[model samples]
Target: MENAILLLKHVGYLAVLRDMESFNFSKSLLSKRFEKMIVEEEKKKEGKNEKLLADLCECFVLLNQFCISKELLSIVLPCLLKVGLDKDESEETQKEVEMAFLALSNINEYAIIDKNMYFSEMKEIIQHHQEHNNLTRLAYHSAWEFVIKRFCLDGSLEDVISNELHFAKEAIKELEELMNCVDWKRTKEEREKESQEEKVLLRWLLTLEYFLGSCLLWNEKYSELIRCVVQVYQTAKGNNEEIGSRCIYSLSMAAKNRAMKNEDLLNGGAVNAILKENQLPTMDDVNTQISLKFLISITGRLKGKKKEKMKEEHRKGLKRKMFEKMEEEGYEDVITSFHGIFVLLEGCLYPFISLNVCDYFVNV
Candidate 1:
C-alpha cells in the first residue's frame, strides 16, 4: 500500500506539473481497491494491526499532495477529517491524526467546492484546533492552509463577497486568537527555533489578507476587523515586512471598497495607532497607495448635508437605482472608476505632496 501510494503520488505530481487544470486522478480501479482496503483496514486495526492503520493514514497524506478527483475527495475528505481531528493520547494515534489533517489541507480546494457537505465540518475542525492548540505545528498549519486556499484568486470569489458574513466574521475572530497566541517577547533566536509556530501565526494574517483583498463590500459591524489588522501591522512592521505589507494592502482595500463609515474606523483608533510609532518599516511600497485609497474613501463618503438630505428623501429610489447599476458596474468597474477621477486631478497635484496619511487613512 505504501509503495503504491508513492508511485501514484509521483505520477499524479507529474500530471499536475504538466497541466494542473487538466490533471484528474483517473484510477477508479485503484480507488475501489483503496476504498475496500480502508474498510478492511479498520477491522485489521481492531485486530491490533497498527501497521495497516498507519499505512492507510500515511497513504492519504502522501497521495493528496498533487491532486485528487472529487470521487477521491468524497472517499477521503470525511474519513481523514473525522479521524485526523480526534485528539488522542496514543503517540501513534496522534501521528495518524496529524498526517490526516496535513493531507486533507492539501486537497482542501476540492473539499471546499462542495460546501454544503464539508464546509462547516472543515471550519469546525479548524476552530476546534485553533481554540485548543492541540494539533502539532504542521497539523495546525494544515488546518489553516485548508481554509485559506479556498480564497485563492483562481477560485470562487463568492465566499469573500457573500452577503452572509459568516466566513469573514469567523476569520477575524481567528485572526484575533492567533494574534494573542504570538509571543512577542520571544527573542529572535527563539523565534527562529520555532519557525513553524511563526508560520502558523503568519497563516492567520495571510488568511485575513486574502479576505480583505477579495472582499468587495463591508459594513459597520466589520469595523473591528480593521482594528485587528492595524494591530498586526503595528507589532509586525519593525521586524516582519511580509505581515506588515499585507496589513497595509488590506487596509488599502478596506478603505477603497464600499467600506463602512470613516468614523467607525476612526473610533477604533487602529489607524491612528499606526502613526504613533515613528518607525519607518511599514511604509515600504504602499504608503502612497494606502494614503490615496483612504483619501478617496473619505472624500467619497463625506458629502454635504444637502447631499445627505437628498439621500434621506430619495433613499429608496436611490437604492433601487444603485442596485440596478451595481451588477453592470461590478467591482472591477468601481475600482477603476477612481482612475478617471485621478487623471483629472493629477495636473493640479504637487510634484511632492507630504500629508499625514495616518490621520484620514485610518479614519476610512
Candidate 2:
C-alpha cells in the first residue's frame, strides 16, 4: 500500500484523484481507517505503536498536501498535535515531534480558515509544545502566519488595530512566562551549551517584538509593555543582532505612537535602558534608521508648561544624548551603509525636515 501511494505521488495521480467525484468518499474512508487504527493503538496495554502512528501522520500530511481538502485536515490535526506534544524523552520520538510540527505548521492555516472553532485548540497545542525548542520556533511562525492572515491583510486599519491589540495582550503574557523559565545566571559555557534553547528564546523575543509593534495604540498596558521590551533588549542586545534589532524596532514603534511620549518612556526607565550602553555594537542599517527615527520623534514631540520646566529639562537632556550618539556613530556612516543610497538618504533627510518644521511651529 505504501509503494502504491508512492507511485501515485510520483505519477502525479493525486492531482487527478482530488478532482474526482469519489474524492470525498475516499477521504472519508481513509479518515475512518486512521481513526480506527488510532483507537486500537490507544487500547494497547503493553507496547506503544509510535512508529505506526508516526507513519500514519506522515501519510496524512502527504495526502493533504496533494488534495488540499479541509476534511482531511480536520481529521489529521488532532492526531498530529497528540504526537507533536508527546513528552517522551527519546531521540526517535523527538524526530516524530519535529515531523508532526512541520506538518502542522504547513496545514494549520487551512484548519484555521475552514473551522474557525479550531483556532483556540491550535493555539493551545502551540503553547503546550513551546518547551520543545525546535517545535516552538515552528509554532511561532505558524501562529504569526495565522494572525497576519486573519487580522492584518486586506483589513481596515481600525479592525486590524483592534485585533492586533487583543492578540498582543495575550502574547505578552505568554512571553513573560517563557522568559521566566530561562536561567539568566548560567556561566558563559553553560549558556553556550544550550544552543537550541537559546534559539527558542530568540524566537520568543522576536514574537514579542511583533506584539509590541502591534500594541502601540493600546495605552492600558503602555508602561508595562515598554518595560518588557526594555528587558528583552538588555538581554538580547549583546547576544543576538537580529533579536536586538527587533527589540529596538519594537521600541521605536512604541515611541512613535501618540499614546506614548518621552516622559512615559523615561518614567518607565526605558530611555535609560536604551541609552546606557555606550559601547554597544552597531546595529544593521535598518535598525539604525528605526532607532534614529525614534529619537527624532521623541525629541520633536517634547512639550512643556512654564510650571513643568523640570520635566522639559529632562526631555531635553535625553534628546541631547540621542543626538550625540547619532553623531558619534556617524550619520554619514549610516547613510552610506545602505544598499540603496538614494532611498536611505531620502528616508533620513526628509523625515528630519518634516519633523523640524513641525517642531518649530509647535515651539512657537
Candidate 3:
C-alpha cells in the first residue's frame, strides 16, 4: 500500500496522461477504470484506509480527465464528498478528508456544473460544511477555491448563478471579520509577507478579486459589495504589491459601474490607499502598469464616462456631486491627498483630459 501510494504521488507530481486529444484511452475506459478502483476501495471499509484514499485522490486529480465524464463524476464525486464532508473527530479520517478537499479543488475546476446536478447541491453542501467549521486550513481554502472558480469560468454560468448573491454576502461577512483582525492603522513596513495568517488573507483577497473582476458589481443591488471592495482595498493595500494591485483591479471594476457613487469611494479611504501606492517606488513595471490602469479607470469613471451605454449627463451629475461633496468637506485637505494620486492620473486617464482640464489642481 505504501509503495502504491509512493508511486501515485510521484506520477501525480510528474502529471502523467494530460494530453486529451488522441490519448488512446477512451473516456469509457478511463471512467470504468476509476470506477473499478473506487469500488475496490469501497470494499476495504473506505474510511479505514485514509492514506490509500489520499493517494487515490492524488492520482485521480493528476489524471485530470477523470471528471470529463458525468458517469465517472457520478461514481467518484460521492466517494470524495463522503470523506471530505465528514465531521467525525477521529484522527484516522483526517488525512482522508484533507486529501478529499485538495482533490476536490483540483477536480471541480473541470466539472461541467450546470445548475442541474453538481452546481447548486455542491454549493449548499460546501457552505454547510463551512458553517460547521469542519474543514481544515487546507480544506477551507480548497472548498472556497471550488466555489469561486465555479462562477469565474466561461460566461456560461451567468444564468446558473443566482441573483440572490449568496457568495457576495458570505464573502463580505467573512472578510469584514478578517479585515478587523488586521492592524490596518499601522504604517507600511518592509518585510517578507509569509506569516500563516497573512498568507491566508492574501489567498482570500485573491479569490475575492475574481468575483469583483466581473460585471457582478454593475448590479445596483450589490452596492454594499462595492463598498466592501473599497474597504478591503483601503485597509489591506499596504500588505503587498500583489494584494494592492488586485484590489486596484477590483476597485477599477467597481468604478466602471454606472451605479458607482464617487463619494462612496473617496470617503471609503480610497484616497489614502491611492496615495500609499503612489508613494511606493518599489513597484516593478507590471505593478506600475496596474496602478496606472487603475488610476485611469477611476479617473474616467469620475469624469462621467464608461464604454457602455448610459446617460452621459447622469454620470456627469455623479462626478459633479462628488466634487461638490469634496468642496463641502474642504478642498485643501482633498487636494493635499490628491497631490500623491493625480501626478499619475492626469496624463493617462484620458487623451483629452490633462493637467489643464481640472482648475482645482492649479494650486496642487
Q: Give the winner by TM-score.
A: 3
Model 3 clash tally, residue pairs = 0
TM-score for predicted model 3 compared with the true structure? 0.61
lDDT by residue for model 2 (1-364), tens: 5674345333322332222223452367775675566556655787966666556655555344435455445546656666755667577676556556545533422233433534455555545454344344434444443443433222333233344334445445655655666566677667665444445555455444444444434455556667776776777665545556766767776676554655567666565655443224443345545655565555446533212224656867865765565455444344233334334323646344333322322222
Model 1 ranges with Cα > 4 A deviation: 1-67, 89-95, 108-112, 123-194, 213-221, 256-264, 270-282, 286-364
Mind giving the per-residue lDDT tens digits that candidate 1 earns over 181-267?
677677767655534445555656655655555554445446777877787777775556556666766665555444344444555
For every candidate, C-alpha RMSD to the true structure in Å: 10.7, 12.1, 8.6
Candidate 3: where is the Cα deviation over 4 Å?
3-54, 62-76, 89-95, 107-111, 154-165, 179-193, 215-223, 226-239, 253-272, 299-314, 321-364
**What's the lDDT of the predicted structure labeled candidate 3?**
0.55
Error of 1 at 77 (Å): 1.8
Q: Cα miss at 339, model 2 (Å)?
A: 20
Q: Assess every candidate by TM-score.
A: 0.54, 0.48, 0.61
Q: lDDT per prediction?
A: 0.53, 0.51, 0.55
Give me the overall lDDT of model 2: 0.51
- For residue 222, give model 3's deviation from the true position in Å: 4.2
Give the Cα RMSD of candidate 1. Answer: 10.7
Best by lDDT: 3
